[model samples]
Target: MSTIAAISTPAGVGGIAVIRLSGSEAKTIAERFVRPLSDHKATYTPFVADGDTVDETMVTYYQAPHSYTGDDTVEIACHGSLYIQQAILQHLIAAGARLAEAGEFTRRAFLNGRLNLSQAEAVADLINSTTEASNQLALSQLRGGYQQKLKEMRQELLDLTALLELELDFSQEDVEFADRNRLLSLSENIENEAMRLVESFRTGNAVKNGIRVAIVGKPNVGKSSLLNALLDDDRAIVSNIPGTTRDTIEDTVTIDGLLIRFIDTAGIRHTDNPIEQAGIDRSMKAAKEADVVVYVVDATDKENLNNPNVPKIQGTTILAINKCDLIDHINTSTPNHIYISAKTGTGLDELKHAIVAPFKEVGDGAMLSNLRHFEAMKCLLAAIRQVRQGLEQGTPSDLVAIDLRDAIHHIGTITGEVTTDEILGTIFSRFCVGK
Candidate 1:
């Protein structure tokens, strides 16, 4: 592989910036800037390019077979001046190192066996993680917890396949080398495990991507005020005028280590105005797709509250009777409703608890956050089910062996034992430059 270089740190000024290089020429290109230092140690020295001093820098080197990319690697820590960062990167590029693409460094690590595909993805997730739960999820994957689980599942399938295939060698003898009852039992076990992982996608997705909650209601029902109250900041525009929010406004807030994205959408009411109607259409769509829906109703408006026009929702819905301060007596007709004043911040705590109530019982086990993994597990479950059904029907060992191999292949794609260039390209492209 050719040598690659990129700015590993964020752009703009900071205390320090890092420019990284990997491949056979990594150390050599780095040596051109700072004097060569002992491997695995940092040396502070002046960086020079084109016979002119660029900046005083600290350089660290790691030799092949032991570094992140499993190749010779160099990290140049320079002062966080935009000019200095650009100058150093240009110097390396001129010195035979090409610019690194998005996730190219991690891709090389995956190719060189330094990390499995899932773990490589975790590296990107760790960088992009917003909440503490997301951080923990990424860290667990980085530490090989996810990889190990998939590995165990694959190994079990492989073992079963091996035994089943061996029986084919003695077909002429009509000798049963493996017990049929045991094979069926093993197939059932693998299927159950795969399905369990498949079931975790819902909770895992919420943890990784945050719980999506849409604040939906009719015109001027305090939907924007409720959003501001939940976020504890004026993130949305509030006004007495109906249809103030003509588009969906979104922001994230962490509640009990879980990120909750509250989307304040346009008031849901019949309107001839194309813009407001479009916004209302989007509001319904947002509520439909959200993990939780907080339907805000004006408690002071007795006519609307008594006959609430609640849309048919798909997920868990929490009734939030807003503007309680205006009401003389908070007498809610609905039994499972929380009355709150978005302006005065009254009963906000009860509203928050109601939002996360459904997902609170989801345990902290290995879960599937990535859609690719979930789909693979679903495919794996289908294949294993085929194996189980074949075993029950007393089908020939060779036919059962085919489905077993298919199951193994599905599991392999998750950890990248089986992969295509298109899938790899698509997965890595989502990462930012120099990951």
Candidate 2:
């Protein structure tokens, strides 16, 4: 492979920036800028291009088989000036090193066996993690969380297959070397583990992508005020006039490390104006699409929770009693009513608790956040089920081997023993250049 180089650090002016290079020629190219580049050592020297010193930079070099890509690698930490960063990169490209593709270094790592496919994918997740929950989830997967278990499952399947396939070689003599009861026990364990991962996808998805909560109600129900109170940012426009908010206003807040995106949508009511009707339509759609809908109501209004008009909602609905500070006695005919003043910050904590109630039990176990892994889990489960059924019915060893091989193939996909270039390209393309 050709030598590849790119800016490894985020673009912009920081205290310092990093430019990375990896390949067989990485050390040779780096020597052009700063000679005597000792392996696993950092040298503070002048970086040069075309006999002109560009900047005083710190350079580190790693020998082959020890670097990230399993090739000789060099990293230059230079001043954070954008001009200097570009100058160094352009100079490197001019010196026979080509620009690196998105995630090329990590892709090379995966290719070199430095990391499995799932662990390589986790690098991107770890980099893009915004919340603590996402960070922990990514870190867990990066540390051989689910893939390790898959590897164990694959070993068991391999042992079972080897035993059965060995029987095929001795076909001349009618003999059964494999134990059916043991095969049954091994396949049963694989089935249970596969199902557990499939079930964890729901929780993993919620932690990976924040939950959506739509704060919706009739006009002038303080939905915007409640939104501002929840975020404490006054993000939405509050007005006494109905239909002041003609679009959905959204913001995110972390409750127990789980992201909850609260969308303050337009009031749901009849209107003559087309614009207001459009907003109401969006509000209805948001309610249906949201995971939870907080139905806001005025505490002082004559029509209280006794007969509140809640639009048809598919998600969980919670009754929010806003402007409770204005009324001394809070009367609610429904048991699901939560009295609170968005203006006075009353009962907002309870509202937040209610919002994340369903997701409160998100465990810190290995879970499936990737859709590819989830689908693979399903396939593995199906294949293993067939294997167990075939064994129970006294199917031929060769026939049983087919399903067993298929099950092993599915498990291999998660760790990348069975993969294609297209799949690798698609997975690595999501990463930033230089990894």
Candidate 3:
């Protein structure tokens, strides 16, 4: 492969910037501008190109089969000047190093067997992770936690498939190489594992890309106040007038390491006005899609708490009685209500806890965050169930082998054991340039 080079660091001026190169001609291209590069050692050197001194930089070299891309690689660390960085990149390109496509380094790593597809994707996740939970989850996947689990399950299935195939070969000999009882038990366990991973996608997606919390309540019930109080900023306009929040006001804040995206929607109330009705329509949709629904009710008005619209909202509803400071004594018919004064920042901590508590079920185990992985696991589980059904019903060994192989193939797609050009392009296209 031809040499590829790109700026690996984020854009803008910083203390330093990194420009990386990989492929067969990586070292040769680096030699054009960077000198005295020792293998596996950082060598501070002057960068010269086109008979002009550019900048003083540090160069590190890695030899083939041991580097990030399993090829000869070079990384140049230079002062974070836009002029200097661009100049070095142009020099490398002028010397025959092509600009790298997005995620090419990690793609090369995957192609060279250094990392599987799941782990390769985790490289992007680790880079884009915004929270501790997301960081740990991505790191776990990068370390092959998920990959190892899938591989173990695939191997067991593969062994059983081999037995099934052997029995197919000795049909006239009446051989029973694959045990029916053992296959049933094994398939059941594999299906259970796959389903567990599928179920984890909810928490995984919420953690990786902030939990969606929709604030729904009647007009003037502190939906916008709760949003501002939670974010500690005047993100949304607060007014005693009904329909103040004509549209869904959205903002995100990290509470206890979990990202909570607060969507303060217009209060739920019947209105003849088209605009307010549109906002209310959007409010209901947001509530339906949200992971947590914060139903703000006015503590001063008991009738508003019993608003028929409140019961229409779905999902994990946190009944927050706003303006509790005004009420001398709080009385609630429901046991699952949290009394809070959004105007005074009272009971906000408990509300935040209630929002993040649902996501606390995510343990140390690797989760299925990617939709592609989840779909593949769903297919895998379905195929495993079919195989289990065939074995239990005493279906022909050859037919059962087909389903078994299908299950293995779906599992392979998750790890890139079975992949195509389209899959690679789609997965890597989402990565930032020069990954």
Candidate 4:
């Protein structure tokens, strides 16, 4: 295959940028730009490239069958000036290296059978991770944790399939090389694991993205003030009048190493104004869908808390009593209530801790972060259900085998053992160029 070249580092100026070349001609093409640093002219050497030298760059070479793509690979570290990076890349292209498409290097790794689809996807996840939890999940996947689990499941299915196929060969002899009870138990175990993986997708996906925490209450209760305090930025407009915020404003804040999406929703209240009513409706919707609901109540107004018009709180609801500094007579015994003065930043730390605690419990470990993996797990679960029903009825081993194999195929889809080009394109195309 021809060599492919790209600027592997992020665009714009930085301390340094990396230009990568991989494939059969990688070493040959790299030699055109970079001269060997060693006196002995070793195949692998630290060197500086020719042309407009941005810096005394380091060049490392990896030989075929031992590199990232299972082929020759070269990496050049150059000064991060855009002009120099572009000049080096253009030089490699002129020296007979084709420009790599988005995720082409990773695609080459997949094509060369170096890594499976799940591991390849994890590469992107690791790069985009914004939280410690997300980084750990991605790193685990990249190290083949998910792939190993899928392989074990597939091996069990393969064993059952082989036994079933052998049984068909001796139909007249009435031979049973495989134990029926053992096969049933294996199917049950696979089904249970598949279901667990399917269920984990929800928590995993929420962790990868930030957990949505919506601040909802009646207007002029300092919802905007609360948002600004949490973010440590005055992003929303604060006002004394009701319905000052006519739309939802979202900001992300990292709390306890987890990213929490703080949404300042328009206050929920009955209104004759159409725009205000629409905002109220949106607030109610966001409240219902949020991972945690911060029910903001004005500490100065005891009447607001008793108001029957307040929307029903759901999920993990935390009652945030705003303007605590101004209220002398405030209830301290309320369950899950946090007293905070958003204007004064009182008890803000406690509020942040409360917001992060729920997510930590939801996804502790073994979370499946990819949606495609989740969908495949769901499909595998359905197939396992069929196998369970077949076992309960004492159905023929042949029919049970079919369901087992179907479940296996669904599981295989997660790791690209059984997948189509359309799915591959959709998965890899989302990656940034030069990855």
Q: Give the best candidate by TM-score.
A: 3
C-alpha RMSD of each candidate structure in angstroms: 3.1, 3.4, 1.9, 3.3
* Winner of 2 and 4 under TM-score: 4
lDDT of each: 0.86, 0.88, 0.87, 0.81
TM-score of each: 0.87, 0.86, 0.94, 0.88
> Is candidate 2 or 4 superior in lDDT?
2
Q: Regarding TM-score, does 1 or 4 come out ahead?
A: 4
Candidate 2: where are CA atoms >4 Å away?
Answer: 165-175, 217-220, 237-246, 255-257, 266-281, 297-319, 326-337, 357-365, 388-400
Compared with the true structure, what per-residue lDDT tens digits does model 2 show for residues 166-273? 999999998877878889889999999899989888668767888889999888989999999899896988999988899999999998888889999999877899
Please state the error at residue 113 of candidate 3 in Å: 1.5
**Model 2: ten consecutive residues of lowest lDDT:** 357-366
Clash pairs (backbone) in predicted model 2? none
Screening candidate 3 with a backbone cut-off below 3 angstroms (N, C-alpha, C), the clashing residue pairs are: none
Per residue, candidate 1 scores C-alpha lDDT tens digits across 40-97 of: 9999989988788999999989988888989899999999999999999999999999
Per-residue lDDT over 1-435 for candidate 3, one digit per residue giving the tens place of the 0 to 100 score: 989999999998878999999999888889878775778999989999877889999999999898998989999999999999999999999999999999999999999999889888888888999998788878888887677777888888888889889988888898788777888898998888898898888878998899999999899988898898889998998887888999998988888888889999998888999999999999989998898888888898877665524544435888898999998977767657889998788898898888899787666556888878889999998999999899889888888899999999999999778999988998898788788
Q: What is the lDDT of candidate 1?
A: 0.86
lDDT of model 3 at position 278: 96
